[model samples]
Target chain A: MLGYIDKIREIGERLFTDGKVDVVIGFAKGSMPMMNEPMMARSSGDLQKMVWDGNCGINLANYLTNRKEKIGIVAKGCDSRNIVTHIIENKIKRDQLYIIGVPCKGMIDRRAISKAVPGEVTEVIETRDSIRVKGRDFDETFDRGDVLQKNCAVCLHRNPVIYDELVADPVVEQTGIDRYEDVRKIDSLSTEEKWRFFDDLLSPCVRCYACRNACPLCYCPTCFVDESKPQWVGKGIDDIDIKTFHFLRAYHCAGRCTDCGSCERSCPVGINMRVLTKKLEMDCKDLFDWEAGLTLDKRPPLDTYRPDDPNNFIK
Target chain B: MDFMGIERDRLHLSWISSAEATKFIDVVGEVTAAIKALGPNTNFVKNKAKAA
Candidate 1:
């Protein structure tokens, strides 16, 4: 994945010189290790600053919402899926994007690395199958597969589903992965146990809204949390309010989420809120046999209605 | 709601025509019984004093 930087720059430079795009949205090295930030390059010089590595986990699709100018976006599998969702929802026109597709190998879980290391990490180096972490007092290496972000570990669509250009050949997708094991465990719990489980899980949240802000699907102008007309949720750290916020946010992403893990990646509290969204994703698959952003021709399950749709829940 | 630990029986949805008063009464009785079986709603009920 480190070798993708030069190819990205070459494509971005050509796009700028040809006047084919107004900006190229990609990733630049972050000030800290394992924290790459999204960059929008307007000139060829800015393209040189772009880089790609396992640390580039932030979804670039979050930057594409409502943009009017032509964009040359560097999209991984998840980012491309979200871009397809954007196009399906009319958030951005498909024609305005020139997708430079990347075959993703998965992203590193910085939190996992922090937990495994004894001291504060100062540098991270990755090869094809392993990662080396360097700290002030400690240096360690671990198998890359062991520290991948939870979603990426179970990812099935590693190659971009939609693209105008390819940076490299599509990588082989993973198989035989049980994607809903956690959701099933929760499903088997009693009502009281489940409630207690979520209560403990969400106790660390400070209502910072990082999960919501990091989500590309959370593009509503007046989010329900902020609306004063009906005052749907209180702006406090109350347990019930926190649960309500997470529940509603998960509901909002029901049939649209692509499991890009942006919400979990951006969470300051390290909450795995993807549990909520993934449950809904699993239900969408079980009931409607659907996956979000795989195609542009059909509407999402929740967005459309049919006579034969599942009605067992209606009694 | 069920996935979040809320009892599935706590909420009910049914289709009844406006003129079918007997069906509505029967459905209401069934829904009431289901809620009664689930006991008091203790999970999501916001504590007003704590929030304030």
Candidate 2:
């Protein structure tokens, strides 16, 4: 974890000093326990505040969309992939970026840790292999690998597919992960059971739009929910409206989302929003044999077509 | 659902797991050839997209 911080600081300082970029987006130690706030450093002096750890789960690529200035970003595998997606979708130019890549083992699950703790956690300390969480009354230690975020646990693309330079040697990517086990479990349910599954799954939503805002892929002049002309979804906390919002948001990210897990991480209420996106990811993998953001030159599955693409799902 | 039937080509699906490592290369090769045959996707683009 300290190695990541050192590498990030070194790269950040050089990029800021060399005038390679106007901003270097990285993570800073958050005031709150188990949170790493995203920081935008404009000068080399500001790199002092930058830190890298498991809490650096928010995708820095989220800050890159629609920006005109050149950017230097500390990119994990998923973040770098989203950068590739941004380039392909014309949201940002590849030349405008200086990507310092980190091969990730997967971020620690803060929610899992909170659940594991007997009391409210006041502070937390992490290493490459273990995390120690301290509460007002108690402290507990656990192996880091045991509590990784669900998406991170199943990540196959752990190495940055694109990078300007490396922070460390790329880690071995996880394979045979059976990423869609949960998706398949839900798929086996009856139609009504599936409806109830999502209805119950989305019940705690407060309509904060944090999920949409956190996704690097969701850049539009006006989001569909805010459109007043036709008003596709109601503004109030209507259940149907909430369902509509989630459905359309996930649909919009089809073939584009790198599954960075930012949307899920940003939600105040712990909704497993990846369930929606992962279904599309699985379908894309099954039918088109494609994954998003793996290469700079190839277009996304939806943006391109095949003459003899899979017709099994079609009528 | 939007891209069903011959329209299904517009919504391509692929399922090459990493466990089948050698099969992945061959699968990607085939998909590439087919998509190249179909060329760039203009079927779903709108006039608004062109202006943007």
Candidate 3:
């Protein structure tokens, strides 16, 4: 924990002193325990406010797309993958970014914690050893392993695969395990059942566009849904409109979504947006042996075409 | 109506997932036949009578 703090401070100071970066985008301690709000540090004095712990789940690389300034940011395993995708897409130049990579053991899902403790969770105490949750009723202690994200359970890489400076020692080599068991269960349903599931899941969407806003990959200047003149999608939560929004987003993110789990995290009604992206990822791999955000030099499968490309659907 | 020369009501296409294989193919086949029956792209008439 100290190692990461020191590394972050050191890099922040260096960047500020050298004028390499104008602002440092990282995590800061939130008012609540085990919560990290995305901090934008401008000067060396603001660097003192930075904090990294078990709860820094929000990917900061998502902010890099529209900004034109020289910025330094903390990148975790999944975060770095999104950065890599940005580099590949030419959204942000690598030289403009000071990627301070941090190793992650997945972030805690606060909803899961609240479920376990109910109304007792008054405050949280996060440290290197364990997170102590204090409630009005009684205080409860949860091992870091218990409340962490499901992705972290079978995570192969606890360390960032790419970084400008290493903040901590390499933990272990991550094993390549498919993280789609839930998706598979959902996929096994009959066509009508699947349609019903999707319809029911999206029934609560108010067309607020929060999912699109929170998504890092959804950086299009004018989203198809937002175009008024052509109006690709209507404003109402009709069956066709809702389905179009999901399908369009999934297609746009094909061979691009890093599975950072932000879309689902940011959804207000808890839509399982990961299902669409994961299915697309699996299809891309199966059809083209292509994985998203792994390489900067390689073109995404959709952008390139081969004469011998497999067309299984063709009669 | 006239939307940048290519009509709005006649700009017909449906987006479906591969998981909806049977329905997807069925819908596409039906939509394509309907569009063919509607004739060329310029023949798009605004169905304003049914407008909400």
Best by lDDT: 1
Q: What is the interface RMSD of candidate 3, in Å?
A: 14.4
lDDT of 3: 0.75
lDDT of 1 by residue, B1-52 (tens): 9889898888899989999999999999999998998789977787667433
- Interface RMSD of candidate 1, in Å, is 1.0
For candidate 3, please provide the TM-score of chain A on its own.
0.92
Q: If you score just chain A, what TM-score does every candidate get?
A: 0.99, 0.97, 0.92
- What's the DockQ for every one of the candidates? 0.82, 0.02, 0.05
Greater DockQ among 2 and 3 belongs to 3
Q: Mind giving the per-residue lDDT tens digits that candidate 1 earns over A257-308?
A: 9999999999998999899999999999999999999999999999799898
Mind giving the per-residue lDDT tens digits that candidate 2 earns over A58-137? 98888998899999988999999999998888889999999999889889889999999888989888876899899999
lDDT per residue, candidate 2, B1-52, as tens digits? 3211022243456666779887778766766777777676542222232232
Chain B TM-score against the true chain B, each candidate: 0.85, 0.55, 0.47
Cα lDDT for residue A112, candidate 1: 98
Relative to the true structure, how large is the alpha-carbon lDDT of every model?
0.93, 0.83, 0.75
By DockQ, the best candidate is 1
DockQ of structure 1: 0.82
Backbone clashes in model 3, listed as residue pairs: A120-A135, A156-A174, A156-A175
Off by over 4 Å in 2: A311-315, B1-52
Docking class of 1: high
Error at A226, model 2, angstroms:
0.6
